[model samples]
Target chain A: MSNIPEELHYSRSHEWIRRNEDGTVTVGITDHAQDLLGDMVYVELPEPGQRLAAGDECMVVESVKAASDVYSPLSGEVVAVNDQLADTPELVNQDPYGEGWLFTLQPAEEGEPEELMGAESYRKLIESES
Target chain B: MTLKTALYEQHLSLGGRMVDFGGWQMPLHYGSQIEEHHSVRKSAGMFDVSHMMIVDLAGERVREFMRLLLANDVGAEPRPGKAIYSCMLNEQGGVIDDLIVYDRADDGFRMVVNAATRDKDLAWIDRHARSFGVDVQARVDLAMIAAQGPEARERVMRVLGAEAPAGTETLRPFQAAWNDRLFVSRTGYTGEDGFEIILPEEEATGLWQRLHRGGLTPSGLGARDTLRLEAGMNLYGADMDENCTPLESGLAWTVAWDPADREFIGRAPLETQRSIGVTRKLKGLVLEARGVLRSGQRVECGASGEGVITSGSFSPTLGKAIALARMPSAAEGSCRVEIRGKMVDARIVKPPFVRNGKSCLQGSPTDE
Candidate 1:
């Protein structure tokens, strides 16, 4: 079973979002997504201040097998991008939720994160996929 | 429905991720593909290669049949137990498939062909063998395992123990030693010292288990692809198919054009192409920028000409992306590869990017 923290929200495309006190949300690929992708070789992150619509392809995560696109779960402006991934992409595989976070996003609208799937629904989603 | 090898159950037991390859359900990886690749380079690793079709040919006219059928000179190595790698081509000089043929002396010859081209290869062989009265039999009852890496031989030899044939340890490169049940060859797709063992189907699982128990990493097709790519080897369908010839696919060495009188299939067109000069040829590419190089990507060689990447991947050994691309002969030094609509700089280099667990690239950024 994949790790699904009770406090985090998930997207259908497998991105996990954590709401912060400053109203910005941090995003990263879920553990299940990293596991499925196997080893990470390169990661292309969205630039800071870049605006993204919901479901837009904001990033690309490449594994040894193939390259995959990471979509934005909600409309937001990229506030911060992970710089460590440029040299140590394996951090995405080693700690997908914490140190491997892809970026920090400031939401364009309030309560957009709540519209996404909750931990229970995300667990069920991954369960059905497996 | 996809076919299963004799070791399907074993792969499942070892947590292998199964994927559809050609027509068979084969393991893509046991766990981490990079780790498996590293294991093969650093120590020992094994691959279940039973899906490769083995065909046996016999009769008095067998030698004549092979001479006409193969692009390589099978007669060059008439010594028994010698293995010759060749491309079976169509009349138009396009590659039908690449295979290995082993001379069995009085017992005739044996060939191992790509599983994806099994039916086509059989039909082509059968159609030509008829006039020569050569007996063509597909040995589906046999299974093959490839043990590769520097320590692969020692581990395999230990596992075989007294059951191994005499002189098995001393088998020369591209040579085979066999008895009634087992055929062990000192040849492998990976650029490493190892053995390719062919035995009866029923004995495959047991051997696989024993080899694993003896400390051979159970590798899968994922690692196999990366390993072969780093070794500068070509994949049959990816690198060359019916539309491409051996001369253009960096396999000119495998084709024996000497003994001009030898009339092999596709010889005339190959000779004509050789005289006229081939416009495009296969070349290796090292991505100078971030991102993976994948098959079907467009390669822009500026004034030279445009081409496509036949096979490309993240080279675990090189710590960067590399590819086998078919480009115009004039294209050299550097080229640009379009990765997701962005043109990225890439360096043109001779392949065998990694061999014998070390980087072969000269002055490459990753070279240490």
Candidate 2:
């Protein structure tokens, strides 16, 4: 079973979002997503300040087995991107929720984050997927 | 329903991530694929290769039947315990499959063919065998295990018990020696010194467990792919299929043209192609930039002509991307690979990129 943090919000595409104090959100893929992809060899992060539409493919995570596109969970402007993944992509596999966060987003709409799935629903989603 | 190998239960117990491969449920990895790859290169590792179909051919005319059925000559006389790698071709000069044949003495030969091509290969062999009155017996009761890398032989020998064959330490490459029912061959796909053992299916799990206890890491198909790719080996379906011939797949050396009178299947078309010269040739690629090259990616050869990557990966041995591509025979010098819609410069080099657990290409220092 994969760990699902009770506080984090998740999208159907497997990206997790955590609301911050200033209303900006931190985002990354879930542990289950990284586990399915295996050891990551490279990570292409979206540029900070770039605008993204909901569900838009913004980055790529290349594992040893295959490359996967990371989609934006909600429309927003990229507030910050994880530069540490440039040399150490394995961090996504090691700590997917913490230090492995791909980027932070300032949401285009305040209600967009609520449209994402809660922890309980996301748990069922991954359970059905497995 | 997916087909299961004899060691399917063992793989599940050992944390193997199961995946569907060639209609069989096989392990993709037993934890971390990269760690398993490193284990094989630095020490020893074992892979359950029971999915590969083994067929035994027995008869007075078995050698003659092989000569007619395969593109490569089986020689005038079969040499006992000598394994020859060859490609089986259709009448159209397209490769049916690439296989290894072991002459097992007593006018008998044993062949190991790819799992996906098992049905076709058997049908082809049987169709040709009817004229020679030879017996083509599928050895489904047997299982195969490959123990590879630097310390592979030593670790396997430690657990092989007293019945293990004597002088196994001195068994030359491409040679096999049997100890009772156990057939151990000094050949492998990983480009490392090791043994590929074929034994009864019932004994497989026990042998695998002993090897694991004896310090041989249990690897899976995921590492197997990367290892073979780094070694510059051709995968049956990815590298070549029934639509392509060995000449264009970097397997010309495996085809024997000696003793001119030897007429094998596809001989006429191959001879014509040989005379006319080949257009595309399989070559190796080393990405000069940051990116992972994958199969089906386009190779931009500028005026030299375009090609496609047959097999590509991030070489764990070199810490960079490497691939095998079928490019124009006239393709000289360097080329660019269009990876993810971007052209990345790649150095064209002869294959066997990593051999004996070391880099064989020039300019790159061997990582010890």
Candidate 3:
């Protein structure tokens, strides 16, 4: 079984979102997503200040076996990116929820985070797929 | 339905991620592929290679038949237990499959071929063996395991103990020692010192457990691919196939043209190609930029013509992406590879990028 933290929200594409106090939303791949991708070797992060629409391919996570695209769940402007992944991509595999966070975004719309699936719904989605 | 090896249950118990490979359900990884690859390079790792087809050829005219079947001159090594790596070619000089043939002395010759090409290879061999009055028999009852790395031999020997053949300790590379229970060969695809042991199917689980207990890490095909690629070895379907000839596939060394009169299968086309010189040749590439290189990616060789990446991956050993590309024979120096719509620069280096746990590349950390 994969770890599904009750505090975080998730997208169907497997990105977990955490709401920040300043209206910025932090995003990273879920533990289930990382497990499927295996050992991450490289990560391509979107530049800060870049704008992304919902369901846009925002990042690329490469493992030894294959490369996968991480899509943005809510429309937003990228405020910050995870520079640590440039050197230590395995951090994504080691800690998908905490230190492995990909980037932070300032949401274009205030209610977008609530529209995303909660932890229970995300767990059910992954369970059905498996 | 896919076939399962005798170690299928064992793989599940060990948390192996199962996948379909060449019509067989096999393990892709046992948690982490990079760790498994490193284990094979630094310590000892074992791979269940039972999917490979083993065939025994026995007859009074076996030597004559092999000379006609293989691109490499098997006659060069007549000593029993000696192994020769060769490509079985078609009439057009295209590689049918690459295999290792062992001279089994009085018992005859034993060959191990790729699992995916089993039917075709067996059919081709059967078709040719008829005229030579040789008996071709597939040994499905046997299971093979490759234990590789610096300490692989010591670990395997400790696990096998008295079951190991008497001459096993002195066996050189490309040599095998066999008793009734086990056939241990000093050969591997990972460019590491190790043994490929073939034994009865029923005993595979016990041997695998013993080797595991003796400190041999159980690796899967995922690690196997990375290890072999880093070693600069070619994969059958990816690197070369029915459309590609040995002369163009960097396998010219395996083709023996000596003794002029030796008219082997596909010898004519190979000779003709050699006379005219091959247009495209296989070369190794090291990515100079970040992104990973993948198979089917276009390679721009500038003045030399466009080529394609035959095998490409993120090399866990080198910490960079490396690939085998079939490019114009004249291609050299720097080239550009198309990755995710962007042209990335890469350097053309000689194959065998890493050997014996050290980088073979010039200016690499280990080079000094």
Error of 3 at B185 (Å): 0.2
Error of 3 at B99 (Å): 0.6
What are the runs in model 3 whose C-alpha is more than 4 Å off?
A113-115, B366-368
Please state the CAPRI-style docking class of candidate 3: high
Q: Write the per-residue lDDT of candidate 1 for residues A1-130, one digit (tens) a residue.
A: 6888889999999999999999999999999999898889999999999999999998999998889999998898999999999999999989998999999999999886555899999999999988
Q: How do the residues B1-368 of candidate 1 rate in per-residue lDDT, one tens digit apiece?
A: 68999999999999998989989989999988999999999999999999999999999999989999999988844689999999999999999999999999999999999999999999999999999999999999999999999999999999999888778999999999999889999999889899999999999999999999998999999999999999999999999999989989999999998888999999999999999999999999999778899999999999998989999999988888999999999999999999999999999988888889889888864544
DockQ, per model, reads: 0.89, 0.87, 0.86
Give the Cα error of residue A103 in candidate 1, in Å.
Answer: 0.7
- Superposed Cα deviation of residue B32, candidate 3 (Å): 1.0
Quote the positional error of residue A73 for candidate 2 in Å: 0.7
lDDT per residue as tens, model 3, A2-31:
999999898988998999999999999999
lDDT of 2 by residue, B1-368 (tens): 67888899999999999999989999999879999999999999999999999999999898888888877776876587899899999998899999998988784888999999999989989999999999999999999999999999988888886757776767899998886779899999998889999999999988889889999999999999999999989999999888888889999998888777888988888888899999998999998688899999999888988999999988888988899999998886799999888889999999989998899889889676
Kindly report which residue pairs in candidate 3 clash with one another: none
TM-score of every model?
Answer: 0.98, 0.98, 0.98
Model 3 lDDT tens row, B176-202: 999999999999999899999999999
TM-score of chain A of each: 0.96, 0.96, 0.96
As for candidate 1, its clashing pairs are: none
Here, model 3's chain A TM-score works out at 0.96
Candidate 3: chain B TM-score equals 0.98
Q: Enumerate residue pairs that collide in model 2.
A: none
